[model samples]
Structure formats: C-alpha cells, structure tokens
Target: MSTLSRVSNTMPTSLSCIDLTVTGALDAATVLGIRQESAKAATDGPILVLLDVAAVTTVGASGVVGLLEVLHLLRARGGDLRLFGSSAALEITRLQAHLGQVTRIYGTREEAVDGGLGPGRARHLAPGFRWHRLFPRRRRTLGWS
Candidate 1:
C-alpha cells in the first residue's frame, strides 16, 4: 500500500503535519482511503494532516460526509486536519454548516500551516456587511470588457 503519511517511524515527524495530496473525483473510495490513512497517522499521536485537493476533479455529498468523519476522528484524538488547495472546492465544501464551523480552508500551504483569517469576530465587515446589496459589478467592470 502506498504510504499516505509519516515518512519515518521516528519522533520528530510524529507531531508534524502529514502532507497528503489527492486527485480525481472526491468520491467514496477516495474518501475511504483518506479516512483510513488519517486513522493510521493519528494512532501514534495527535497529528495535523494537510490535505491537498487542488487536483480533485469533482465533488459530491459523500466526499463532504467522509471529510467530516475524518475531522471528527482527528479532533477527538486531540489532532486536527487543515485543508489547503482548490479554493473553490474547499470554500464550498467547508461552507457546509458543520464543516464551515469546524474546519478551515486555506488557499495556500503557508496559510494552512502558519495560519490565516481564523476565529474572527462574529460580525463581518466585508464591503456589503453593514449595507445590503453586492458592490455593483459595474464598480469593477466600468471600462474593461
């Protein structure tokens, strides 16, 4: 079986993040593999698994469900899973009620490891936060095609 995590059986890498990248459709079988690998990696100690989903071609309910299961499994063991890649996929997937509330989706590896906008104030002050309506696209598409 291909090793999905932990290059060494030594101590240093035990508590570090395991980089696991996946491609193709984020389907049942793929998620199952992820879950199993994560389970194995977490067995030794609380581990941080950085999942790269940039190459993933499709998304479905099963993928999201399986992700949640893995997240729960890790957190329960005092570990965590931070996902970085395919902002669109990560954003949509993470936006699911519970997923968004629990996990984070970063656009880059640095953001995932070092950190990014996280645990912010409940109130958001985005462009249209206080007022209603989106910033008219006209503002950005004034002259350009």
Candidate 2:
C-alpha cells in the first residue's frame, strides 16, 4: 500500500488533475517524491496535482520550500499543484512561511476539487490598496534618552 493513496474524482473541469491523500510529515523528500509521481502522470498529458493534507502529521520550513519547488516545477511543465484539507500544522506553516503555497489551501475537499483555475484569486488586492493599513508600519524615531 502506498503512503499516499489516489483519490479518484469524476468531475469535469478545465484541468486534468490527480488527487492524492498524504499522511505524516510533509517534508522535502515527500514533496520531491510527489513531483516525481506527478512527472509520471504528466507523461499522459499536462495535469494539476492536488494533495489532500488533512492527515499530515507535521510541517516545517523545509516542507514549505518543497511545496513551492514542486508547485513551480509542475507549472513550468504546463501542470500545477493544489492542496486541500484541514490540519493545524499546515495552517501554521502556511502563515509562518508566508512564501508560497499559502493560497493553495482550500477549506474542504469540495472547494479544492471544484475550485477555479486561479488560486487565491479572490484574495488579490485591488490597485492602490494600502498594505501598511492592514499590516501596520513599524515606528522608528531618532532619540537620545
């Protein structure tokens, strides 16, 4: 039995995709392995690989970097990587990493499977939106005290 099981979905979408359920730590090696598997699948044609991480036991910076690498690799080959599932560790990593794969997360399998081509499309800000307002600027002043 494979640690990551295939999740077959029979839905019509613009993307040709494969759904895999992953368990345990989502480390770099695992992500790289997924990239290799995705490469095999891409032999048939371009595909969007979706990983279900609900059962992921743990996550760290390496995992985040791996995800970003895999994502870029797939996309470069006319494919993509999407992730869905509920795991506190994944959420924490996403927020803390603040790099890639954050917007790739979907709340539910349905949302992920049925989501549109654009990841985090709705999350994009409008033109001229002040980021400082949302993030708050750090204050600094010259003082001798």
TM values, all candidates = 0.66, 0.72
What's the residue-level lDDT of 25 in candidate 2?
A: 84
Model 1 alpha-carbon miss at residue 58, Å: 0.8
Worst 10 residues of 1 by lDDT: 1-10
Q: Taking the tens digit of each residue's C-alpha lDDT, what string does model 1 give over 1-145?
A: 1223323322233356677777766767778888888888887889887787777766678888888898899989988887878746555655554465556666766566655644652422322132334554444556766
State which candidate has the highest lDDT: 2
What candidate 1 gets wrong by more than 4 Å, as runs, is 1-14, 96-98, 117-145
lDDT of 2 at 117: 35
Error at 78, model 1, angstroms: 0.8
lDDT of 2 by residue, 29-123 (tens): 67767878888888877788888999888885777888888777788888777788888888777766764323557766656666633565554
